[model samples]
Target chain A: MGAAGIGGGTVNLYSWLSQFFGDPDRRHGPDSIVHRVGEHLLFSGEALGWALLLAVPLGLLLGYTGKAAGLVTALSGAARALPTLGLVTLAVLLAGVGDTAVLVPLVALAAPVLLVAACEGVRSTDPDLRDAARGIGLTHRQVLWQVCIPWALPALLAGLRTAAVQVIATATVASYVGLGGLGSYVVGGLATRDFAQTIGGALLVVLLAVATQLLFALLIRYALPAGLRRARD
Target chain B: MIRFDGAAKRHPDGTLAVEGLDLTVPAGRTTVLVGPSGCGKTTILRMVNRMVEPTAGRVLLDGTDVAQLDAAKLRRGIGYVIQQAGLFPHRRVIDNVATVPYLLGWDRKRARTRASELLELVGLPPETARRYPFQLSGGQQQRVGVARALAADPPLLLMDEPFSAVDPVVRSGLQDELLRLQAELNKTVLFVTHDIEEAVRLGDQIVVLREHGRIAQVADPATLLAAPADEQVAAFLGRDRGLRGLALRPAEGIVLLAANTPLDGWTLAVDQEGRPTGWQRSAETIRQVAVFRPGLDTLRTALDSAVLSPARVAVAVDHAGRVIGLAPRAAVLDALDAAGPDTAAGITATGVADGR
Candidate 1:
């Protein structure tokens, strides 16, 4: 935190980041930056998990059969325009409660991005590979599972990476309804005029988002098939 | 034997891909369905595997309707190869080859062992087995495709333009490998191609096709070349097919002159082991010595060598690349006399100048 230096020195953004990461005092205390980050991640992860479960199979089916693909394109375009806060408020009002209230909007925010990516990924798999699989005696389901799915993994991972970041950022809104995420610090800090706590909380969320991005980048590097990796090279 | 009894295919848009295609492909032989594009060669080949079922009539594999067989089980029992190899990019070369065996529930070790052996059988280097398909050259990848198709040791193999994607040199090499494999394994092959030259080279019974899967003629390469069924078939066969026919005839009967004999002031050179090095004329050495194996090579190769040689004669070598003797262009041309009327008339009409 950019804490006021006692007497002579003035703290900078670097010191605030350092304090946010290092010190166990103030912003770094229990129920502070680390604790709030953990809480934020839990909310993001659960919402993302639910979204993936519901969206992935549906997306794959749409992509494979080539139905509603255009609708997804239109829907995904529309998804970006809808405000996340408004969605959360609307969901809370309608659902009238708790963890599910936060989750509904967070999932709504995440699923379309993942769904569109998965559908397009699977849809764009090489026709040659598909023909070869069918020609080589694979059953229809086997072709989809063994060849189509593996070939579409790059798209799937890309979709997951995008959704993961979006969900993480959106989960902060949970603090609006007295939820205890990193967002709580921002919401509480503004209410109590504690700007340092707000900056520290915001920085932790940004750090988490960057880490998620890098994690997906690593997944792309090590988890992708050698052939596709060679293509990247 | 595989038989197509009036097999036909009409797409939903009402375009007839094949119409009343009736053909019998014999066992233990390479039957090539060859035509221009849209002639239904591939459609016919796919019908055997039931990949594209016939709209009418039937395709029977060994007297059993292929339509009646479970497509997956049928495909597992028969090998299929396609253009650009259609290889699974994710699989390593060895795993690609082992695909069918693995599909058939062979243990991993057993499947891989067979795959490695097949890699060698296709004349690929042993190190190729571990590399991914993208890492291989076009020809090497096609070899892996062949190895994969043969993994299950299927009684029948369907090949669709398998070597067409490679350059002529690699195409010929792959073609020769297929012939060698066919000779050893004797899998009944139904190969399809648009190239007439490949058809003549690889086909034991070449089925010439016109549009709409119509069979023009089915005959051995030599017979097809010697006597085409119609002017259309003859035109497709090309005007110079008589000379090309010598490709199928053995060069064994062609007599060779002593290598010591000089021609065009150039003397044939040899290494200590009797393998040909080049042609020697005065102080200069000609780097390219077109040599052919008399007992093993086709007569066309001997003639080509004779024409290519600066000494105005082909060098005949034994299997070890040891120089056996020399063949003058005239003698090589005269050997065509032994091929019956077509060969004799070709020589009589064109004479020696055009023959070279």
Candidate 2:
């Protein structure tokens, strides 16, 4: 824990570097780094899927109706204050340790970010646009789908990017609830006194977050209306 | 035809936007509702399309009550244009123009074809169809707005200060374009504007409104300027209403003197194209020779030319811009007298000339 620790930590930089690039001895069979990376993605992706399922329609509805806007902001603010560890612990106690315990807090973590983004995206549609759309004979439903949704896509995607990054970072807590994901290394490393494994696992999570951000960045670039893209550039 | 029979709109706050309004907009003609701000001219225009539902009364389109019609369907059958052009920022110009057609469930190819036709009709270049609204200037956006409104070929058009956001030069150009389009298409248009000059220039029948959509006067452009209902309307028409009235009359009736006739000590100079170059008197020359076309130009143009000319005679030209003859200021005045008192009462040839 003295000179062996680099940057005032017990983890050796040389060991951490080798572990990051080389095959790990700890993971056997399906628990390999590649397999764990996939599990981590699946775990975080499920959380995001659940968050989007719950938040998107609700956000679109609130945004289109322009009702309960304050509630969205308040909910997002309160969700931001939630401690992932505490939620995971409570979820485990209430529902028993499983995917549900790991997922509950991560979904809670991601949904509000998405909900606020979706709501704001739709709500920020130019009032003049709504008026013109209706005047030009767009039905209420048509206005919502044709005008509001397309206009909201950029903001919604932006929110998705933010939520995806947060969910990936926080999904490490899955290891706390007896789940298999990239978080296995950190929890298992700490237990076995293998600090290099902890650092390498943490680095993998960082890589995953960056990858998600880049993926969404490309989606936003391609998915935005051509006019919107031109305007931004 | 659209009729507002006792149409009134009272807001939830008990504010009257338009009170007990009774008016009829004739079919296939331009009717402009013009007044100062807060006069409810826009409200009156919106009523025809049911954008503003008359709270106390009904608006009738053709023989049926507009209130009874499905609002979206009714709006689809009537074109609506507003200030800021209100073009969808996300759509290409063609797609924006094709909105109504697309909403009507027309096939994409057909809608786009109609949109392209409309863009050309509104004087936009073919390439403009591929660009977005923001890529164009304010005036071009307005042209696209007009094109979009006309895409479905609706029988009626509602324009709420459609050209007000543009510069004065562009506004004039748009007004000219509207006039040209109106001549060819003859759609029933209800235009709202705060500018009386715009009302006179574009309206077949101008309705001057007071506060709360009260009708101050409704008359053809000439009569409205020549004879307003009261002092308020006269003031609203502005101090130059008489001179403005001349713009509505044709220059057809003026008696022209021979092109070769000599003015006292002054000679008309002509270029190789036979267009008047200047009025020459010995070594001195007045290079500015105001000219007008008798068949195509307005009485105002004729009068303006005569007043602006150094020889006090308007040079008459044909379509080719070659000299046809000349109309002295007196002859122009005589033509004004022949037109009738309704247009000539407050206006005098000297008054117009002196104003310059």
Candidate 3:
């Protein structure tokens, strides 16, 4: 699709909004909105799950042992410097344009945030608390789980939300290769010059990102310890 | 008993944090390591808990090598109190106290029950049990720290300048509480402090350390004040050794003059509650009355009150804060002389005994 075709196409922002959100039969009629948003949710959720499983524990471990903390910092810096679009495209080329290619880059993109957050959570725990925990007879493992991780929860939860949103926003590129996600709308709309569909899909991703942020806020609010849950004046 | 057999610490940078030394900390008594900053007093105290591992020799608790025990298990068996109390900010005061019990697998209800009991034991208001550590004052937080340390009822407690961070007024109050608690609990307390007054006040035996953890003196407070090992030890004890020494002697020896008798033309004025209000002369209230309890207060306090009075007499008060009698400065001096030579060792040997 050429830029001229996109420019010449009628871009009815209201029509796109009606079809994507307001109108029932034409949009919510077949529940395609649900289908597409679910697919987007599934992809980001998968990426977040993988990041949590792989990165959070390692980050926390590095925090507890502290020997690998510098390594986590360096790796987070290196990962942030990664060119996301280039990485996804290169991954598609190397891994033959499938989930292998797509998932790898997504995990790489998301894991670092969670990793760094966990590291900081562990590192920033009050020194006195650590001493007290140990002095009070908690084993190293108990100290991490009962004291350190719980204390670091606020940071880790924030990291989780951040990685989830980033994953959702970036997943739009995946449909470039014919994947089933909200990205498919943008790719499919542009190919046929369906400007409304393209704009609709982009807006949906933004909505999902905003929703994900709120979801995380809720999670953090509930996950925090009782004493900390109350907002300070 | 805690025994240190040539225990020493040489850091990775080749700094001798504490030199090898042999020492025994008797059970059921407070053994204080007091000295100037950088004298390695802290290092010596940490060594008992294996926080600072000794490079040579070993530390034994009740004849078992501390190094052989798992660090966490060993630490759990010991109560460790630091400066500032170190209460967990994220936890409620009760939960903070219940920390060790929770780790020991006490059920929530059991742990919390014990925790509330301890909050009361530490003199915290019952309402403070559910509050966070930050909501409490520095003095209250310190009391919580003590409660937390005693939670698992560890027979030994290691306090590193635990009272030094508070105002002198609160610091002494906390010291008094610790002594009162010790009288009842009788845990073997290893307290660290740079203040000689604190050492003389709270320690049954004071280990005065010089640079490199060198033992300048190892004696009871009286013995230590009466006879420092050398000039360095005496210097570290500070210039007011005479006044500080009186801190170790109880006020019991001084004869108390009946409150009805006026001294040097000055009379004790009493409030409606019978508490000493001040010293009144024929004309007006000349000074606020400084009173010391004969059995409960130290000789230093008795002498202090007498010296501070315009008529040079200290009033004695009962537990109710009512005026009981007066102690003349001459009588205080006579009591000291009767105890023996002003040497701490002499007074201590003469059985002017005290314990924290």
lDDT of 3 by residue, B84-166 (tens): 68777678999899988887789999999999998998898899998987788899999999999999899999999999889
Structure candidate 2, residue pairs in collision: none
Quote the lDDT for B25 in model 2.
85
TM-score of chain B of each: 0.90, 0.94, 0.91
> lDDT tens digits, residues B158-265, model 2?
999999899999999999999999999999999999999999888877788899998887777777787777899898888887887888778988999988788877
| Of 1 and 2, the candidate ranking higher by TM-score | 2
State the C-alpha lDDT per candidate.
Answer: 0.83, 0.87, 0.82
- Predicted structure 3: clash tally: 2
List model 3 lDDT by residue over A1-233, tens digit each: 22233333345566555555544532553337787778778777787789899999899999988878888899898998888778888988888877756677788889999999999988888887787677667788988988788778888989888898999998887777666688877887878876667887888889989999998999887767765554231
TM-score of chain B of 2: 0.94
User: Which 10-residue window in model 2 chain B sums to the lowest lDDT?
Assistant: B347-356
Selected candidate, larger lDDT, 1 vs 2: 2
Q: How close is every model to the real structure, measured as TM-score?
A: 0.90, 0.94, 0.91
Best by DockQ: 2
Model 1 CA lDDT for position A10: 40
For candidate 2, give the docking quality class from DockQ: medium
Q: What order do candidates take by DockQ, descending? A: 2, 1, 3
